[model samples]
Target: MSMTPPPGWYRDPSYPLVERWWDGTAWTDHRRQPGSVPVPLAPPEPAGHGPDRARAVALVAAGAVLVTSIVTGVFVLGRNDDGGGAAAVRTTPPATPSAPSGAAAPTGSSTAAPHSGAASVVVDELNGITLSLPKGWVAPSDVAEDDLVMTTPGTYDCPGDPGLCRHGTVASRTVTANAERSPKALAEQDIDDAANTAYDRDVLGGRPYRGITSHRLLKAGSVAVAGRAGYLVRWRVRTGAGPGGYVESLAFASSVGSESPVIVRLAFDAGAEGPPLTDMDRITEGIRPTGDTDTGGGVGSSIGPSR
Candidate 1:
């Protein structure tokens, strides 16, 4: 009677330079280089003298004999062809991940060139703008359609709900729907929508902040962004749950020679755990045209201090 070999790594019939995992029943996809440390296998089932155990053993023995014969034949043939030595195995490397279905493939660099002098920056090719990433901030893993968004490094359980929440977020996008509106008009008009989107209900109908209870205008004034005239509106929003935060909408004309306006939205939770409120002004000061040489003019020309 043939005896079955226990589950272990064995010479791969297909690749002479590597060993494939055998689980007693069949070959697995897992493989490793020759002479490498073997992976631990599952412990064998306890032996028994029952009729069922005998039958199982008999079946396993038969299967093992067949597998051994096949593997021996392949190994002998490989050795004979190579004059008694292992043959080289060529493997194709994994391909890079492509964009998801229906999404445009990214073109050019996603990050701004280091000429801006900022420690780090994120480039929005669609809107032809770039925003500086603060020390504790990072580029978002996923961006909305036509919008560039950045947020603080980690997520936390939202105080109002069980959903994931970030302490701070800054989003930039072109005002395509109403391109003709002035910067001041656009800033004033978009502040409420920005606040609602940030603290009220999310896109999936989940109330992360339990909805906004009240909001008061904190600052409204003209500013210069990327050397273009702009306007910003800030508001202190009180949510039905949590220690409500601040939101701001800044609108400016595109510096990419387009008549379209660009809007940067800001949101920050109010607490010691949240990002410093001063980062709002610093981020605003860091905004610039994608390829502009001068970074010091645009946001420094604010009419009043940011709160």
Candidate 2:
């Protein structure tokens, strides 16, 4: 019996409702073709690779839509005829030869150049002190600051108020002898001075040296920076000011090439009775140096002033 199919884009009833009798083949009209050759009736495309090929082609089209949307500063969404879901639109890329993997390299790309090597500094954190030095050798600290001779020997920075500053300890006036001193030393000196001058606290470690003084605080480990080695130190203390005024100190040491050693010291004081030790440990534990290569650079020695 002769029957009328649905009006628009319907497949013949004899076919699987997939082959279009209008063009007489599988659907290929992404756009209306005015007078092209009518597609001939053919067997349905094989199921497996056909779907995969269709997916790949859809991805390419999506990429093209995306580029166009980006250039126009607008978003464009699309969907397949199957009603799966909306998809990201993309702009078409310039045609290029496909590689064996069926993917094309980006056009107008330059060859990747090799990186140049710079003089490397390695940090080895030993015990509680950190040292920035060459690989496989102990770095030395001299008793002189860079060209600024210490008028008073062995004193670091002057002590500042703990309430006003992070490092609660005071430092004596001392010369930073070697330009190669790790960041740790300078921070220790600063902390010492802050504790001493501000709160009348004594320094457990002397300037550029360690002392066996009473410390509610401590330091240890190695923290590296930018392929250069340095160390980390953690310390804790209590103050007589606010209710349970406790202070925690942690320092990151990194040797800046030819520049003064960069010491990042962090301190937190909640009260005179908080868990300064716990806080100190937590902060110091999070210090990790980035951009370090495996030339064996790191904190190699204990965290403390070398005897």
Task: Write down the TM-score of every candidate.
Answer: 0.59, 0.27
What are the Cα lDDT values of the candidates? 0.58, 0.26
* Per-residue alpha-carbon lDDT of candidate 1 for residues 1-307, written as tens digits (9 for 90 to 100): 3333467665544433234445554443333333434322222233345545434532122222221111100001112221221221111112211222221211111221112222376776655667777777665542221232566643444656434566777766666556456998988988877888788875445677888999988888888887788889999999888888989888887766454777788888887866787888788888787777586635655656645
Which residue pairs in candidate 1 have backbone atoms (N, alpha carbon, C) closer than 3 angstroms, thus clashing?
Answer: none
> Evaluated with lDDT, which candidate comes out highest?
1
The digit string of per-residue lDDT tens for model 2 on 1-307 reads: 2222122232222222122212222322111111222222222222345445333321112222111110000001111122221221111112211111211211111111111221122222211122221111111112111111001111112122210112121111112243435455645544543333223432211121111133455554455433445455444444444322232222333332333344333333345422243433332332333333333333333334522
**Candidate 1 at 53: error in angstroms?**
23
- Stretches of candidate 2 off by over 4 Å are 1-188, 196-217, 220-228, 243-259, 270-282, 285-307
